[model samples]
Target: MSEPGGVSTGGAIGLVAGLLALIGGPAAFGKAGAWLADRADRRRQSRADGNREWEAKLKAWEAELDERAAASLRQCEEQCAELRAVVEKMRFAMVLILPEVERFAPSSPLLQKASSLLAEILPVAIKPAPAPPERPESISA
Candidate 1:
């Protein structure tokens, strides 16, 4: 129906209402869209934070492992040095005792002297190997 404005009033009203509905619909959707975007942003930020924390923990564990390894290596070196010193002392004692043994005979007084010397020196010349604990059942009757 024609109105004083020279356009159909009902059509004009319908067109304006349709435009407003279209624009307002998107505006309502914008809130839900923004909420979803905020949620995604929070999830991404939390993941990044968790990754950073895990990286820090891994680095700390690696550093601790390295420190323990270094300490163990140092302790091993010290024990090796002590063992080497014992081996050297045994070698020196063997060197001192051998010539005396070679110069003596099996039944002579000199041989008796050499045997006495060997008995005194042998324990000092050798480092005994560590023995395993004996089982009572394995003992000879």
Candidate 2:
């Protein structure tokens, strides 16, 4: 007999039995569960391997870029040194010309301008790289 507002005991038993069969009891469900777990593990391992490969590539690229940047800086410094050398030579020529102008034209504006221009700009002298010490000739006994 059914309760006033709840399932009958017989109906409840039938419903539980149906759910157990639909879910394949224990053995069948266990195999499916194990397969799902294995698939998840494989996927996790694959992702870790992919991450390692990507990280390795990034590190290699970073090293190459650093090397290129260092090489470029050296080239730029060399160019700058050559330019400085040229400027020093030009300054020397200007100094030599100044005395001649003063002797020829005592009231020349060109001499005054040249003197002021040299005085206004700060001269930066670049020191040459020191030569390596010469090894004394070894006396063969």
Query: Highest TM-score among the candidates is held by which one?
Result: 2
TM-score of 2: 0.63
Global lDDT scores for all candidate models: 0.73, 0.77
lDDT of 2 by residue, 46-125 (tens): 99999999999999999999999999999999999999999989988776666666665656787777677876763643
Q: Estimate candidate 2's alpha-carbon lDDT, on a 0 to 1 scale.
A: 0.77
The Cα error of candidate 1 at residue 92, in Å, is 0.8
TM-score of 1: 0.56
lDDT value for model 1: 0.73
Lowest lDDT block of 10, candidate 2 = 122-131
Error of 2 at 22 (Å): 7.8
**Which prediction has the highest lDDT against the true structure?**
2
lDDT of 1 by residue, 78-122 (tens): 999999999779767655655555544334676466556656755
- TM for every model, in the order presented, reads 0.56, 0.63
Off by over 4 Å in 2: 1-25, 122-141
